[model samples]
Target: MSETGRLAVRKTYKLFVGGAFPRSESGRSYVVSSSKGDFLANAARASRKDARDAVVAARKAFPGWSGATPYNRGQILYRVAEMMEGRRAQFVAEVVDADGVSARKAGELVDAAVDRLVWYAGWSDKIGAIQGAANPVAGPYFNLSTAEPTGVVAVVAPPFGPLLGLVSVVAPVIVTGNTCVVVASERAPLPSITLAEVLATSDLPGGVVNILTGHTGELAPWLAGHMDVNGIDLTGCDPDLARTCEQEAAENLKRVLRPAKTDWLADPGLDRMTTFLETKTVWHPVGI
Candidate 1:
């Protein structure tokens, strides 16, 4: 067929769960628009039920993913960067439409997102070395402690810098073998689903990172209070919402990273990765 005769494929933005794109079980979608209020596309408005389903998928995926070697996980993350490179144009366009930034600025954001993935990938295999230590116990035993993943995490991605911020939050969580359910920027969620496409095809296992598009206020409470979730990052919530989520999270003693003034462009320290990690110590007889 001639090029002109072919059709341009249309994408229906849907919730990314279990490595597959599924519309919200509630069968509802909201109109996504540009910063100037121009219509862009319709996106699935995920419900609390969807949040639970994502958590289930994340919990199911945790064992295998956490069991994999850090080097293997790093390689998979590098693969995600490669995939993002291939879809640069789409991501840049989405960022432009979502944030009303110039093409060049969007391009820079896309580049940073790719680089951020690579940066976290490099840390994957080295985290243990930097964070683990040998205890100086006064006994004939070798006492060693190392960082381990904190199981399934719930994240509220920053409302700004949809692509870079989303990548910043999600990459670190998964790089250390923790699976996550993220609520993307409610104002500019288009780039998130596009990112999910990159993850789905980049050899990443299903359910390692599930993204939901909708109101953070509607979803944060349920994710925070869920008994099965091990941590919640309130990076996107306002003070009031963060307080509510924190209270809910306290019910299960979920490890919570409180909302902070974050400069997305600044050097992201080790906190994001370390925040979702727990230390495991082992003791062995010195001579045995």
Candidate 2:
């Protein structure tokens, strides 16, 4: 048989949960198309049950991931950046198809995404010092406050700039000790799942970051309403959907980040990583 007669091995795109690739429990899939309406592939349409399972996985992984030293988490995240660098070509190709841009433009987005990861990774160990404070009290006591992770967070990635937006949102949450269940951009999810493959191979523990593809409006509500979830970021949600999710999240008093005008290419600063964090303060009487 001639080498040219070989059949290509098609990829089965599925949900990334608990560090393993699994088909959606509902056994449902939807056709994914390029920006030009060309057939790209089929992606799993995650159901409510899948979202629940992802939250459970995140809760289970929280203790260890959160307890690891800040420096350690930063190193692991930096490793993921390294892996992404190795797969630069593949990411650029997917970004081009997903974002409907020329190869050169896609390459730039991919480069920005990789640099974004490193930026967040560098912040992992330094967040506490920057965000924490030492109080000046009237009494003979010492007071200090430091930031801590708010447990499992649900994220809705922005619909545009799939790779860059996704990286911008996810990197900040996990780099600061929070585990996340991200509902990827339905319109441009190919690069997201490919990112999951990179995370799975990295030193990151399972469930630290889970990616789900489906109707954003469908998944965001359940995550917002989930009692176990500590926060919700609606940067990707449309106004109506964001409103609905915000209402649901209020039931548990979850920290809700409403959609805002964001230029992903601009300087991000520290807001994204700080959004999902909580402050802890301690006081001690002065010692002789």
Deviation (Å) of 172 in candidate 2:
0.5
**Candidate 2 residues 168-260, lDDT tens each?**
999999998999999999998888999999999999999999999998989999999999999999999999999999999999999888899
Runs in model 2 deviating more than 4 A are: 1-6
Q: Candidate 2: lDDT of 245?
A: 97
lDDT of each: 0.95, 0.93
Worst 10 residues of 1 by lDDT: 1-10
User: Model 1: runs farther than 4 Å from truth?
Assistant: 1-9
The candidate 2 region of ten consecutive residues with least summed lDDT is 1-10
- Best lDDT goes to which candidate? 1
Q: Cα deviation of 199 in candidate 2 (Å)?
A: 0.1
